[model samples]
Target: MLQLPHQSLQVAAVPAQRTAAREDQDGPWHTEAVCRRDEAGLFFAPSKEPTAARLSREDAAKRVCARCPVMVECREHALLQPEPYGVWGGLTAAERRVVLARRRRREMELKKSASAA
Candidate 1:
């Protein structure tokens, strides 16, 4: 029932239903994603999109993600799958890479401490 900026109510409803059906078959978390009812373009950049436009679009997409019930699940999925594009779980692809790197560093530190102990 939530309508996104520049998106019609009718447009929002269709994807919501599709996401619901997908959830029935795929899983429940996806059905609850706020992005499911929104346009994919809001989250993804087109080829050669302007820098300002891409940043604006990504910020809007992150706003939707901010309210998602399944945000943690979605973020974890993105992290694990290493999705190569778009804004996932409130993070840009670059942001996800940073997170992954930090995690790897922390893990290595822990391993080193364990081995030393």
Candidate 2:
């Protein structure tokens, strides 16, 4: 079985202390993540994983994300970090890429409109 770091595993178990620390370091939103209660393997793929298995695992992780209260924050973090692996905020790596592309395009369009005006 894959084991997460001790700190990651303890997030939900020690909410008050962890939330305060995480808020100081990363942000308060992470303290409310539902994924903290699940196994890390559910969100990240194992090395050399098969496509079907990876899809199934990602789907399961997304289901957990779907109900999360901090999903938007998590997704924004992933997009800003351009997270290269795993499923974050109900989206796989490929999905994040598409979103980034769209964001870039929109920004470019906005810039063009501003310059034209």
Candidate 3:
């Protein structure tokens, strides 16, 4: 079905909007995140959390993020700000570091290829 501009469509009880609220579907949609209703502790790791506890905590947090309405925007915001803590977009900070590293490597490879070409 065709939705008019600026209109949001949800398929279920959860607010899984078909697209972002922005005109281009990429605006600051984090404002509508379901996480806002959850406790802040759910999204952050404890300073002295053990490895096993951290893993379990992160997994639980990821589940919440998976169903979040603004998962994409939250992830983007975390990466752009280089958030030093917490679980965002179903990824712990460490996981996001790995993604960023991979992205950097890919960018370098692309640059090298372009220069060589």
lDDT of 1: 0.70
Residue ranges of candidate 3 with Cα displaced over 4 Å: 1-27
lDDT of 3 by residue, 14-71 (tens): 2232333343355557666776775345566545656766666566678888888878
The per-prediction tally of clashing pairs is 0, 0, 0
Poorest 10 consecutive residues of model 1 by lDDT? 9-18
Local error of candidate 1 at residue 29 (angstroms): 1.3
Please, what is the TM-score per model?
Answer: 0.77, 0.77, 0.73
Please write out the lDDT profile of model 1 over residues 1-117, one tens digit for every residue.
Answer: 224466422211111122222244456777678876745557666667667666777888898889888888778777887776788889998999999999999999999999999
Model 2: per-residue lDDT, tens digit, 16-82? Answer: 2122223434558887789887545677766666776666667778988999998887888788876
- Give the lowest summed-lDDT range of ten residues in model 3: 8-17
Stretches of model 2 off by over 4 angstroms after superposition: 1-27
